[model samples]
Target: MSQTDVAQANPATRDAEVLIVGGGLSGALLAAQLLRLPGRRRILVVESRSELGRGEAYSTVELGHTLNGNAARMSVDPDNPDDLTHWLTQHIAAGGWPESDRQHLPVSQLFAPRGLFGVYVQQRLAEAREQGRARGSSVTHVQGEAVDLEIDRDGARLSLADGRQLRGAVAVLATGMFPAARTPQTRSSGLNAAALDPWDVAAMAALDPQARVLIIGSGLTMVDAVVSLEQAGHRGPIEVFSRHGLLPHVRRQPPAWEDFLAADLSIRRPRQLLRALRQQCHAAQAQGIDWQAPLDTVRVHIGRLWSQATDVQRRQFVRHVRPWWESHHHRSPPLSAELVARLHGQGRLRIHAGSYQGLEPSEDGGLAIRLRYRGSQESVRLAGDALINSSGIEYDWRRVARPFPRQLLARGLVTPGPLALGISAAADGAVYDARGQASARLFALGPPLRGMWWESTAVTDVALQAKALAARLAALPL
Candidate 1:
């Protein structure tokens, strides 16, 4: 048999210089950067979704699910900061936007719809693939879920759900955010199939117009639920419940403030850092500047701060300060903020601070929810037509029911990270095995790196990580 015969014999085994699982923003951007580097190689990106860049977050068909950040700040290219803005301008021009309407569109600062942003990402990836092909490199996008990874000394074998095996020099796990996991209380509760996914616009709209909705989280996801409901013309009252009852602050483009915390090494502990941050915020407020200025400065050094934290400090931060930090740091888009405010003012939305006890069947063919009020020991009961689990991404790996991750844990290909936030991996993206040793053939990026970088989910952060990972992979002996 000749080489061609052998190739035909092993039809299931596809070869690639690099194999990336989960072709969301992280994998797609990494493929783009790697193809642009000074070498030509074959890159394979496997995604379950039909679209390359749009995972669950951006693939929504609802136009009302807009991006949380502005186009100027959400570019996929770190080197070209205004790439998305420029792309949007060209896109609008190509779409034949009237000249009078062009000025009204703020490509730089406006929050584009999430679906449109997904298109922008897909377009960029397509361009990158074209560039790679022009330079003797190649990119292949396969629509499938990667179920398992088999590792050896030379490389790793990826098993897809459709019984396909891909052999590559290295494998990268870019599995994006997981769906919200119900708490133990929710599991034991009799309300089965009662919790609706916040992103299910059709199902949410199918509810009765006067049905009361109980949202189980007050973070950005809850905000998204609100936007979807309003778009579907839902006139029912919306109730948001969370332990802290803190809502995301509205996004703003503030002037760059001095990064005072970058040089403050003494603030190593979470308590010390929080105190210092408060002082900075107060000083900025006293000077008639928004507290966001000081918080923006902290973003510059957040990675370093998170990396330097001790295990105890990290745990303490999660237990005591995570809620406040998330609400303040990850803000809602301007349009979303305005809509939520108007709804609240109109008495259509209400937020409560409490703990969800359980759910019981209501007399009116709905669900009755029990909650322990924030300030009182007495429980409160609320009746609603529907409940939604908008509690955001469940970070704890032990709790997630995803099959691939569970398999990885059972085989000891990866270990849980600190605080069980995500998979354990080095800062350089080399994944650790059951024995806590880094593997050369296996790597990870994006949300799975939350343990290493607390703020790894943002596009900007993922872009930076992709660039660095591409550079490091380029230097590796392939």
Candidate 2:
């Protein structure tokens, strides 16, 4: 059913029928699904990291770093809502992750550490691999970065950073989100070079215990940075600069509110939806219920609402409501949020409403930065012994300074997505090429489809996309 090209470099071993450009959560989930089906085709996954499931999000070793959502909501199996919960239950029963008892929360609502979650994902992939092995199907991990790709009538040829090449009938771009602090940018902001990685607790530990630390952005990432600082025993002042100066709300398992979006079809515009949501929250709060109850209902409808909005409406939403929406929807975990709240209340973590201009010359032998406060035109200067650019992920592929994205854009292999949030792709994750043609051999999912699906980075979002994309690839004649 699948046509795979033979690798001339090694005639004895046939090339993969499907080549995944990344081996992160999205790639691993997709591979697991593809392997589960009754097929004898070979699959190849190329990743720069030594591990497959621990992408940028899960690679952190800190136990303080937890998933944004709880186990019930973070399932890799789309068909089974309690897949993660069940796995976590068995995992705990086996005396694994004894740290999970701190909160005394149930397994369903317990927030698993990102490192442990990576283990769960890897175990799932391992099970799929064993199942595939018995069926004569095989999946191989190519430990290299894919720098370039060429697609022709015959198949796809991928060139890696180590001068190795792989050919396959179909190739999927599962490259996950590139964090702003780590990824190289087209226009170098000396910030990344000077700032400490938000997840790097070891580097943070090396700093002075009382060193004033400067931070950028006040979203979930900023919360993580604060957690890292606490773990590193750094107790100095933290200055956070963002345009809105807003922090993410804590994620909660609130009572289920009525699905108002599904019941009412007339509320299509962004403004209309906002008004209705406010009423729902207000109503819920009036009844002594959690305000998050109503907001939770909107998660399932975001895809339809985002995809159907006009370009003008989309722009309006981005300019007017995006900040608020992000802070509310993409919330922080309870423990992390509590730490942030405590720090903020103690005046140690001060949030300044402003736009970061750039680095300024330091006169006191420390890193200096300047930013214009929200309502003022004049710039304010601040200096600290250490800095962290927790400005979030870099989704725009064009601005990424990596060799692969640069080569893809230069060769006209793909185009920028809507609002420049990721690569352009069709409804079913088929990548749109330079001329707006959906390539049959190329597919994408997860964060790469951020522009396509407004809420594409969550675990549930990636799992759903992985399942659908796997089914499509299996049914494809190519």
Candidate 3:
């Protein structure tokens, strides 16, 4: 069916058994799983954006923006472990790529483009709709922003920005990550045109190639913006600013299996876990394997460790080790890493490690950014024609100025987690209110719940959460 016809159907205007607020990867996966259930249960997904499958993270048009992890590790299907690998092979075949080149690379080392992954997800959703399953418990995609949610004795009422209301027996808040927070100096000085949000495609496309660009943060988002500039044919010099100025390490193919971490090893404390990981790294190196293999072993246990950690331990991890951990754990794809290397080799990309002090208007309508470097009491300055806020999602819930979450917290319907990183949620994905009561009807399953679960961003971790949430929603009394 045409997209216009689907919009005209308006099945989401009616009541539904399950109402999903976000149509990102988690929501789409959960919707697909719900359709597989035996009994009938209506599933309506309300997405603020026009596209259903491509959320902010996966919506890039640039082919250089590939998945950080390998294809073999990412799959929505828990039962079919090689689902993404099979999809990659089919995709390459359809694209007429040489089979000789495809067969040599390990499935675990293949890095697919983000857009291709989005297309794969859309295809899966389409296949689910083709079967008779979607007809009974239909998956309706609505294009509207959910502004307010009213939870009362008679289920939940969702208020959209366009004055429409959606009633559902159960509502899931899978609203992914919060948008990057803007600095006050940029806002008050009328420098909005100079400072761009990385996700704002329209603004990015309007940038002039001659203009000098300054990216705010030096992480995955910065890598994405740099890649987007190159893909868009921009040739201007780019400067990346961050507290540590540390770029993501490149991901490489893993070597033969090494015995470092036992499958059943359970270390909850941050200090103890770090010590054990360091020891494992040395052991793996002596056995002719890189330390990263053992770290990958630790990644499998991160969720369990986070759940068992005390508040003090969690704070210790965040305060003392999160920066180093993030840079190493979230490695860049080989293509992106090569691009950065080339840019640095050509002297077009400059990275600065410092804390942003402020920004001032230059004489020629450009921006002069002030920053304080490490071990320096004095401030330094850099001039740029345009600046991009490529910092990843702001985890502080209190800093989020959006109306939906602000209203929810004001009404005691939601509460921030122990460290105020994001919304509090139980281990089963059920959201906890201010009274510390888990609402069986409301659940959050994504990076927004990072305060409660530290390892919730990657595709594999989120897929597991989606599966667990799908089971819970399926078992709900309707």
Candidate 4:
């Protein structure tokens, strides 16, 4: 198609050549991908937040909240694994992130604050914007929440919360992960309504120094909640509850190991992969090496292994191996892990394996919760001064009470992803409608494709998907 045909001149009919529904990391990276490509089209990104790159994950201003991965592995550039490290090097040298001195590690191994990472993402996007401008392409940020979207033979029409509408040749849904602590649910236990936000240190600060705190879920989020409480000066007893009561293993820098998955293609089934991985870990331990060395090699093969697995195999993994996989894979940062270890040693933090039943009526102005301890049928009542819902991400769109997610499901624009993790989509990111048909106009990236790619939420996965989707959209007949 000609350059003129790529961009429509009518402001009413075509506000942009492409419309991105979310302006978080996923959306921002996708925009960068499209901008760098040779094109002459207008792109508009709609986000509710004032800032563009920081979504729920990176929007936190707390110095204690940091990315789980180090700078080397968290690059937004798929072609360059060291991109974040390079940026962080100059960032530290320029007197930014003064805390870097405490780690005593090279910039490549440093764990960066989420706020600083957001700045890096924004700067990269700005550079891409300049590149796009030189190629007669432009990107505009529309500050508003996208509530509804409709696809047509020509393109897509998007509606914002403030009653504004925009038309584009294609629309992309990059709405990031919805943390259970904050996102509304259709049917909830009312825990979120009464609980303090997991990332909200200010709310935690209001509590008495010795107030007892109850926490639900013991994943990386729970680790963050502990860090938040500590930073807020809360020295009270903390009770953490979950079905498994498993804590994330602390992250460590390990040496490179063999890419076992690449060398052995027959290890496709979950059991087979697990057995092989176990053998590798045993071998590494025998050699006085960290087990994480071998585990990191499997990161590149997850999408292929997940997508190609049978439904039965996938179920087996989720039911039997999922909790262990999560605890081992999604590791806690060292600094936060140190605090948790110290507190646990001091008897200030306790972990219980139980299932939360519901809330109870409390007369002492404290939060009361009922729980059935593991292996017991009878429920028990537990009370605390505060509660936090660190239950993790709600990937099922039907359950999410957000207007946009609800609208998309109600309108049949998208379907629940594999195993109901995120919305379903083809390997190339063309979203599948409720009818299981791949869409040409609608696309999704990041956490929305969790069901499609089991490890889709990581920065590397999103970066690769953004680049591939941008190329697919660029080739369209729009």
Candidate 5:
């Protein structure tokens, strides 16, 4: 008589055309695309949060945590490249944006607070839902966490946290990024001293303004933390350390350049691609153009090139090239970059190339952090009132303590991605078992597909994948 009993008794009666887990950008965009299909279809989106489309990255309400790019570059729809720009213009016209916030910048190039973008995504999803209704389709949003997945002959059944079960003809894992799993070094230390969330405004505000602060990563997340400290009127010295300590480059408008890599599908290897990219960077610099223009050329071809790479070559890139590639490709916004530079100039911020060794309780009831410098193994000690982990999300699902991923691995529903970077799946997002056989009713998108597509994080890439997956799932017999 319960939902679980009903789901097990009559799977088809409980089934939807597609069941999308996570309800984040990947799921929402896929739903949007599914609604555009010619035939009637049902999409059921399951989310842990009450709202849909915000995901973890855009879920922050803090003003200091802003998107890394301008409004024009963040649209969920690739066909409408300037959709966000147009939306912002309309939003500004309707007095949606604050007047004080509007005066200093161009709307097209503005790096608005991430919460505003979340609202935009929600609005877009609502519109798509209505559009689906007009086209004899339906999208239902369910609130709960899917703790386990069971594949049956009929389809797949998802067990929710509240003891409810839902069935769908097919399922897509749009689970995005998971929080970093605590390493052995981080685990032994007192969490109060070192393991603070990077996005907690209250925690950052509680820090003593004059006390030293230590941050564990030198990327965009660290930029957000610095901005939060400054906004809270903290005048303390800050230390940022990472494996390479390579900070993201500041974003800038660049002149268009020829897509030199576009025509060259022959450069399939990572080393060859790196060499070609370096040549392009040098040529662009010689022409007084930013090297990013050349780098962007490789973005579209990444999935193809990555698929062609051998496992050993993929491992080589992960070990040797990933850090520099991330720093070069994932640049920070102009405003945040300027703030970081200003802090460094004032001698209030210092960046070190090193790896965290351990954390110890200091004499002053603070954290004594140990690190090994990049080139040498000598340990260095530093003390701070608090340490925040800004090292970003952990992509390897095996390490995370989440229940659903563990269930999938145990049931042989999914495998670790190529090089153990993300959830392993086929190039088109079909879920694969440990034996490397693809599933007919299970799929994935977004960050979980990073193993197949190296450049899977950006909105542009997610949008393309969502569109493709939607079309593929839509055409399948229900």
Candidate 6:
């Protein structure tokens, strides 16, 4: 099809060489890199949210919502590992901030506020746009939700909720995590007041300060909710319910001479790697350093270890060990952890280790949570003024409620991975269809590609993927 014909076919399409969905970190970074390429191809970015950089992760209004990971290790630029630190220094210097306030620390030591990081990302995008404008290259940013994706003989087409469409030679899906799937019983009961997703800030805000709140899971999301509640001046008692009543560990300061996992450790099998990691952790602890040091080393080598694992080993890891791994690997900010501890110490927070049977409406117009404790023949019921599901994103691809994945599955444009955690994609993030044919013009990134690359969700891993994908896209002929 001709360029004019393509542009005329869709309202938002203007014959761009590349189109990116989801203007979060990955999409925004990709757009910036594409602008650096020596080409005149138009680039279009569609974001469902009004904000370009915040997405779901950094869009919180609470100032207490800090990044779990440190800033030194969270740079958008892969070439310079210290780019985020450099940016922080430059920003502080330009603003005449005190040097005492800004210290050179380990990337894992700095828990910057999530909104500040969002601002940094937005600044980078603004610079890219300015550069593109100066070079006379077309760049467009559209604010809309992409509800449908159609891949025809000519190119890719995206249909928005507003009845507008965008066509491009290539499209990248970086839509990030979908909302958590609600329990069947909860949905059937028709109670919309319960917050099934942590992103429902309005629902969380609507609760009275004196009302009791029950959080579904005890992970990072739960920490975020607790921190947000405290920041909002909530004075009510809070309860966190999970299988083990396990909360995320607090981030620790790194030791000066900590070295556990060697740089040359071979990780070809999942079990072997786990054993080695445990051994390294033990050794580090024995040396008077925290086990987190060794775990950090392992994180840097996770992609290689995951790539080496057999399908059975991968499934085993997910089934038997993924939860434990996540609790340790994804730690909470020290401040958040301290707050949780303080709440517990003061009898304001209660953590229960039990299986959530279901929820029932109480006579008092609250929620009666029925749960079964371990080794108990009898079930118990607890009442809460509000319920918040902080269970994290529902990972089962079959249960996803979004239109793009469902439509893609119906059209045979995508298939679930062997373990079905996410869509099947090649090593380079090129998505494969149900027919087992890889699409040359389509790719998947971020959490959706978790099935293929087990370590793709974290900021460090996604940032590296963004840089590599940018170079790959730049090399592609328009």
lDDT of each: 0.82, 0.90, 0.76, 0.91, 0.82, 0.74
Cα RMSD for candidates in order: 4.4, 2.5, 5.7, 2.2, 3.7, 4.0
Cα deviation of 240 in candidate 6 (Å)?
0.9
lDDT of 2: 0.90
Per-residue lDDT of model 2, residues 1-478, tens digit only: 1233222223233387899999999999999999998767688999989998888988888889999999999999999989999999999999999999996899999999999999999999999999999998888999998999988766778999989988887889999989999999898769898899998999999999989999998898899999999999999899998999999999988988999999999888888899999999999999999989999999998989999888888889989898999999889999999999999999999998999999988877889898899999899888889999989999999889999989888888789989988989999898898999888878899998888878899989999999999889888653
On the 0 to 100 scale, the lDDT of residue 294 in model 2 is 94
Task: Point out where model 3 deviates above 4 Å.
Answer: 1-14, 96-108, 131-135, 181-193, 199-210, 256-266
Q: Please, what are the lDDT tens digits per residue for candidate 6 over residues 71-127?
A: 776787777777777776777668722332443554335677787788888887788
lDDT string, candidate 3, 1-478, tens digits: 1223222433454488778989988778778777776678788899987877677677766567778878877886777868888877777777633432532566556777787788888887777655526457678898898888876545667888899898886789878776473422212333334577664555666778767888878888888778877776678889888888898888876664544445546565888888988988888889888878888877767777887888988888888888789888888887788898899889899888888777865797777888888778999888887788777777766666677777778878789976887789888888898898887567888876888778777777777888888888777665
Backbone clashes in model 3, listed as residue pairs: none
Ranking by TM-score: 4, 2, 5, 1, 3, 6
Better of 4 and 6 by lDDT: 4
Q: Can you write out model 5's per-residue Cα lDDT over 262-323, one digit (the tens) per residue?
A: 77768889999999999999999998889988987777788888889999999999899999
Counting clashing residue pairs in each candidate, in order, gives 0, 0, 0, 0, 0, 1
Q: Return model 2's CA RMSD, one decimal.
A: 2.5
Model 1, 1-478: lDDT tens per residue?
Answer: 1223222323234498789998888888899889888778788899988778888778887767788888888899998989988987887778722331422546787677888888888888888888888888888888887888887655778888899888887788888777573332323354326787787778877888878999888999998988888877789899999999999999887777778776677777778888988998899889888898888878757778898999988988999899999999999987788888899999999999998888865787778889997998999888888888888886666666666787788889999988888899988899999998887778888888898889889999999999999988777656
- In model 4, pairs of residues that clash are none
| TM-score of structure candidate 3 | 0.90
* Superposition error at 145 for model 6 (Å): 0.8
lDDT tens readout by residue for model 4, 1-478: 2234434434457888889989999999999999999978799999989989999999988878888899999999999999999999998889998988787788888888888999999999999999999999999999999999987655688999999999998899999999999999999989899999999999999999899999999998999899999999999999999999899999999999999899989998888999999999999999999999999999999999999999889888998899899999999988988988999999999999999998999998887999999999999999899999999998888889999999999899998987888999888888888888887778899999999889989999999999999998898656
